[model samples]
Target: MSLNSLASTIEGAQLVLRCKNLNDSINFLTTRLGFKVRMIMPSEAPTIAVLSAHGCTVRLEMVPNATPDAAHLRLLCKPALLPAGTPPRLSGPDGMVVDLVDAHAPVHVPPAVQEFVLTRLAGPESWGVGRAGMLYRDLIPSRLNGRFVASHILLPQGGPVPDYVHYHRVRFQVIFCKAGWVRLVYEDQGDPFVLQAGDCVLQPPEIRHRVLESSGGAEVVEIGCPAIHETHGDPGMHLPTGAWLPERSYDSQKFVRHVAAATPWGPSRLPGFEARDTGISAATEGLGGVRVLRPATGPANAAVESEALGAPGAHQGEFLFLFVLAGQCELGSTVLGQHALHAGDSCVLPAGADYRVSPAPGLELLEVTLPARLPA
Candidate 1:
């Protein structure tokens, strides 16, 4: 049969092993381990046997001088498989080792290694191809020692993306549309919608979603906690589920779509700039807050035209990141010194770090912080 025809009839997989004595290997697998006999070939001689255990299937073939594969097989199952005070390890008759691990281990969050990092737009060396063929520039090369991650991603040759219905195993995540637009769909979140430039969304943990397509040259800013996380694909899930449960919780965090045009811009909590709130803080329940910082426009922002984000100490969170969306700005940090940042430049500040932002003409900066609110 042709490859396509054969692929159509494909099913699960079974590991193959060579054994010197098929009966001894079968007895050891069935008696000591929790495997059940499935098939025995050539009933009279019984030189081949197939056994199944815990969703895994194995085939044993008797060979006078067979040597087992040196591969290590690790299985996630109940710890009760081994006796008390015994390690979850065993050796098969073929000399292969099996390791049992707890299936429901608690989530691991790496400790934060606080530091100051700066990425310049001129650094073309940082941009590389990432998932779904999108170009990604690592804003935080260190990832703060894997405690956090921020990226400037772009879809240069945009259109129908290869992304599918999936979800992230993340403590927190947010994506901002920096330029162009992209169509997206989330589980039980109404219909497929377009994420226009300047709009942002909070993708709480395990919220199944997909990126259907994007306009040409679309750019986005993606940030997540713990830096390294898992993206699980659900091929069975269909986008737009046709269910509009806006308040649904994905493990205690709600999904939020902050539209730039609809959101009202107001005076910033800081002295010299106006703020456009993304409403992420309330959605994540103090997990974090995201907003756009622009030069103060009206009376509320008239008094001080110097400090845009804050003077030195206004909002202090465990993590803080800033991306220059447009124009230029001067960032002065007490501990890290001063630097001039232009469009496409990004910066990361340690928790409780003293810093100030001075916006130049038409400066539009994106700010993100953890723990959501500021101590007024």
Candidate 2:
């Protein structure tokens, strides 16, 4: 729990959509939206299509199967909880499909449009393997802080997670359960911590924490600071290192205690950790700083009358990365392609760019910030 290394922020999401016909979907995306398509899978049984248009961190996939009767489309649309009606409201009869757009450098999404996406995306059926049934909603990017942010992760039904850990080059993460329950097993500790919806844990840099995947599945919303690299140094060195701790047994309390003592959540909190009730404000936190905003204040709001986030028209920081972690927001400019960002969508801020963020009814956003460069 001690403030481990900085986590990675989510930059963007890979949206998988389905259509009555794969060829039609691909043609619409490429001809109308300016996206180029590639064949990830080729076979008459399950025709496959991939879209890796410019500026997209992930690709969009389209799979066709005559038997599933909308299984392929449902796979993509349901994850985001898209509406049940075929031909989503966004696109025409076939539904207007969009590729990835450069949300500045970070990511951003409007509230109203976000709900439109999630409404059709959510549900028990949308979750997938190793995915825990979670649909990424907001991908907030912070240039000042040098990482992106994400929230609203859903775990699918049917079982607990296998004992595994995540080691990423660009992402430092914190996973929180919004619904259901599960246990956390660390490599150094013998016992496991039970976490339910609303409870969150910070995985130290390179620290490997295991999720006891449940049979009924679980939903965990996670925040990651993408682009936060790990460093290696001699033992006892305080440099940022992301090494996974070897898994051990609970009976070995001595080893657990030893590691616990060295972490921020040690003696005081078991996992040296911190939480902030004020809510996430900027695009990045200063090096070695941790911010845990509560669910009440409601994510980050830019155009609040108080100018809570920033002046209505003020553009002060180096850059701003915005995303709709929960709910929705209404802001400047009409987002191209995907309409607006839902809980998992993200947008980047041009360096030193100025913009306003206003949350929609029930909408909340988490934005992180960092300086252009560290002081010498």
Candidate 3:
């Protein structure tokens, strides 16, 4: 068996150190190093004490013969989280060495209110192919003040795409195939699979993947948090190269591949509209959800109510948007008065905004929102 086959997921790591005086060591870590005491062995003359600071945890054990040349604790922390001009190394009461290393800062703040905006494709002349033979049209540029971006990607002459194995450092992201098909291979996903129209995949952050091939005129819609993120190439790793482990996790999230044809249409927030869940909710652990919504066919306006036609209701999230796949509709809110939507139209609904959508019969919408679990 390989080493990876025997390895289990590690939740966290805590360093153990020997200290001659636990009380003095705790005082130095708390007062000098800005660490907080999480626990202590005893109220009087404690032998062990747990200290935490800047994402680092340490267990200090009182030892009678402890010396300064004992094991050292190396901590990785964001530079901004630590005090300015903090020394790289520090000594505790028993000569315990603690090394602090600079790491990338992780900070996120959602918008207070959602921004109502819209975009429409001009014409074929505007669909110009760019890098990697992919034509991308940004959908939500002003939404969440550019914290999130939804784009329409198309490959006019798709085949073996000019791409490389890579991964993205993002909070949340997903790709839904709108037209044609594309083949993709992700690390630990077994083999390359083709994503047909109506299929979607929730790509967890930092998961290595690659776009292998695509049919001509293939189109897809990709939504991601923070609007911008880095896509780093993995020259050392190759897809379908590792053991097949679908249950394997990347940054506390699992990869999800949802097929619209396999998923049944369920009830949606709007009356008379049915939704097809994309499994992104469970994948993100309530971080976000994607759904294909369509109005139930029968009467043109049987379930439409004048009072609730445009009544706005607020939602709790960092991002929310809709991409129209077919038919037309009118979305309205207190902030953004009635706006017409048609095929290929994309709209961004800001956070905590009251909004309503009145769709015409046969209207199809691809909806995405952050924090899959939201207040009704």
Candidate 2 vs candidate 3: the lDDT winner is 3
Q: What TM-scores do the predictions have? A: 0.76, 0.39, 0.69
Candidate 2 lDDT trough over 10 residues, lowest sum: 265-274
For each of the candidates, give the backbone clash count. Answer: 0, 88, 6
Candidate 2 regions with alpha-carbon error over 4 angstroms:
1-153, 165-171, 187-190, 214-217, 223-285, 288-325, 333-346, 371-376
238, model 2: CA deviation in Å? 24
Question: What local lDDT score does residue 20 receive in model 2, on the 0 to 100 scale?
Answer: 62
Error of 1 at 31 (Å): 40
True-structure RMSD for candidate 3:
15.9
Tell me which residue pairs clash in candidate 1: none
Report the alpha-carbon TM-score of model 2 versus the true structure. Answer: 0.39
Q: Could you give candidate 2's per-residue lDDT for residues 1-376 as a string of tens digits?
A: 1112101112343555545676566567768877654323211122444554665422334444533222111112221222233232223244534432222222221121111112223454443322222344433322224444444454545465532343322233445454567666654444565665444454544443456655254655554544233211112222122333434222221112112112232110101212232111211232212232212332332333112233233333333344444675544433222234466455544432233444455554434333322111
Error of 3 at 185 (Å): 0.4
lDDT of 3 by residue, 1-376 (tens): 2434212222334587888887679779978999865544322124666667898888788989897556676555654545555677767767677666554545243453466778987777545443345787767655366477677888888689976677776788899999999999998888999999999998998788889999999999988876655554566687887578878888888999998888988877666677899988888789898999888665634333221223336665566678999898888777767788998998877655677778887788998977775553
Ranking by TM-score: 1, 3, 2
